[model samples]
Target: MLLGGLLGGALDLLYAFGFAASRGVAPTRLLQTIASGLQGQAAYEGGTASAALGLFSHFAMSLAWAAGFALLASRVGWLRQRPAFAGPLYGIVVFLAMRCVVLPLSAYPHPVGFPPLSTSLDLLSHMFLFGLPIALLVARALRR
Candidate 1:
């Protein structure tokens, strides 16, 4: 689960940076925004430290979601039996958990305000880049 989280988080961060850059948003600002979830907007002013924190926070969140799925997969035989299908669905679950619960209650930019295209892209990324990797990795662990 830890390995899946780390790799998936790194992959997701890369995808996020590219997505944000294409939209005229600075990558550093995006990283800072991750930290903002915990430190509020002031995290942007924190410079390198805040970016570091953001990176850490991002991985922590990924790890948590991965752990959650791993726990469930371990306990639920049906889930372990169908990674290809369940993975993307779990990604959607992770996305909703963040947008509806995690981000809403956090201090990050309010309302999320993702454009239609961006929103779709984010959802796809979560499914393929985030949740799928975690699911596949955890599934592999189960096989072992």
Candidate 2:
């Protein structure tokens, strides 16, 4: 679970950071945005402290996702047998749950909207970078 979460979280953050950089957004600002999930708009004004909190929150969420997947995969044989297929699908699931359910229920200050280009990229990143690594790592570890 640790391995999967760490790898998946790191990859997810890297993709996010790269994407933000391409659009001229600083990593600190991105982190602050994440912190806003829990701290609301005040996170943006909290500077480095909020950014750190956001980073911690990101990893915590990743780990929770990893642990949940690991638990389910351990009991579900098909998941272990089909890492590549299951992983991407799981990523999609994660994305949907976060965007549709989680965010709506969280302390996020803004309403979530699906703005085509960014939404597509975000979905692809979750599938390929976040979910894929977690599923693959968990499958490998459990099979041993």
Candidate 3:
């Protein structure tokens, strides 16, 4: 699970950085935005320390997600029956969990909204880059 978390989190963060870079947003700024999820708007005004907190927060989330999948896979026999399909499906579930549950419960106000296209792209990326890799890697480990 740790291995999956590291690989998947790194891949997801890289994609985030790349996407932000293309938009002329510095990577640290993006990380700070992530930190803002926890620290509120103060994260934006803060310096490298806030960005570092965001990086740590991101990996912690990844590990939690991976550990969740691992726990489910272990308890539910059906999940192990079709890892290929389950992994992608789980990705969507993860996306919803973040968008709906995590965000709303965060320091921010209730209900979440973002630009339509950006939300769509983020959901897709979470499914493919974050959730999929974690599920697939855990599935591989289970087989061993």
Q: Best-fitting candidate, measured by lDDT?
A: 2
Q: TM-score each candidate.
A: 0.95, 0.97, 0.90
Cα lDDT tens digits for candidate 2, 1-144:
899899999999999999999999999999999999999999999999999999999999999999988998999999878989888888999999999998889888888999998899999999989888999999999989
How high is the CA lDDT of each candidate model? 0.89, 0.93, 0.83
| Model 1 spans with C-alpha error above 4 angstroms | none
Model 3 C-alpha lDDT per residue in residues 1-144, reported as the tens digit of each score? 898788878988998998899899999999888888899879888899999999999999989989999999888866666776776788789888888888777764334877788788777777788777877778877878
Model 3 lDDT at residue 127: 73
Q: Which model, 1 or 3, shows the larger lDDT?
A: 1
Model 2 segments more than 4 A misplaced:
none
Sorted on lDDT, best first, the list reads 2, 1, 3
Clashes of 3: 0
lDDT of 1 by residue, 27-110 (tens): 778889999999997998999899889988999989998999999999988777888877889999998888888898999765
